[model samples]
Target: MSRNVILYIAMSMDGYIARKNGDVDWLEGDGSEPDADIGYDEFYGSIDTVIMGRKTYDQILTFGEYPYKGTRGYVYTSEKRDNNEDVEFTDENVEDLIGKLKKEDGKDIWLIGGAGVIDEFIKKNLIDEYFISVIPCVLGGGIALFKDNNPEIKLKLLKTEAVNGIAMLHYAKR
Candidate 1:
């Protein structure tokens, strides 16, 4: 089977992925009892490769340790950066990169995003699936999950589930 490029991410009810400052502290959700398994572990297990934007990677660095330690990671950027033991920084065209990745024998690829990267992937129709967790909050304004005037791409909802007040929506390109 061809490897799938999955856009797995969380967004606020109003459709913002993060605050204007790129802070996701709101994801904790009213300091209630810790969130239950929203199937993150299961989803993480299905992807061996991760693709993210430089801004997302930089934001992750502020958290100290790299969360995706063992997974093969590719940070998409226009700047020149040396590859580390954890990730390879590249400016390769999204379509060409994804085409090569899909041919490799491995688990699905995770399109971890920060808006710009997601937009590029969407433009090229490279993402095969979307796993979105809708958190319960509205940030009036911030970085949006979907930009205005994007190309219309229809999708089919495959599943929906609620866990700890968070709604998880799974979709496949139609």
Candidate 2:
């Protein structure tokens, strides 16, 4: 099967993935239900590899335990760091690296993010699909979804669903 690169992420209605300080407290749901994953398990199960930005990796470290242990994880970073047996850090060109990965056998690649990595992939036209969950609240000011001066890229809406106040918008490159 052809490998697909998917951008699966959640953001506020105002289009900010997290607060200006990289805080994602707004992403947590109120205790209306004790164990609501909102299709996360299904999405995670479908992807075999994950690529994320360095800042995103740092934030994940603060989450107590590493989350993508089961998946082939790569962190895009220019600086050298201690080798992680579970995750690989690379400074290689994004376009070249992703092109090589796509040709290999895999279920799908998950483009987990911070704005910089998302913008780079979009610029290189590497992303195949996007699954954005627009949370109900809006952040007045923070990191925008696509960075400033991004190239024009069109998308075809594949599907949409409203799950517990969150608008899950799925789209494919057009």
Candidate lDDT values, in order = 0.91, 0.88
**Candidate 1, 61-116: lDDT as tens digits:** 99999999999999998999999989999999999999899889999999999899
Candidate 1 wrong stretches, greater than 4 Å = 30-35
Clashing pairs in 2: none
lDDT of 2 by residue, 1-174 (tens): 889999999999989999999999898544455376588999888998999999999999999899888789889988898658668998789988888898899889999998999998988889999999998887898988877777777999999987677788999989
Among all windows of ten consecutive residues in candidate 2, which has the lowest summed lDDT?
Answer: 28-37
TM-score of each: 0.95, 0.94
Question: Which candidate has the top score in lDDT?
Answer: 1
Best by TM-score: 1
Q: How big is the positional error of residue 94 in model 2, measured in Å on the Cα after superposition?
A: 0.7
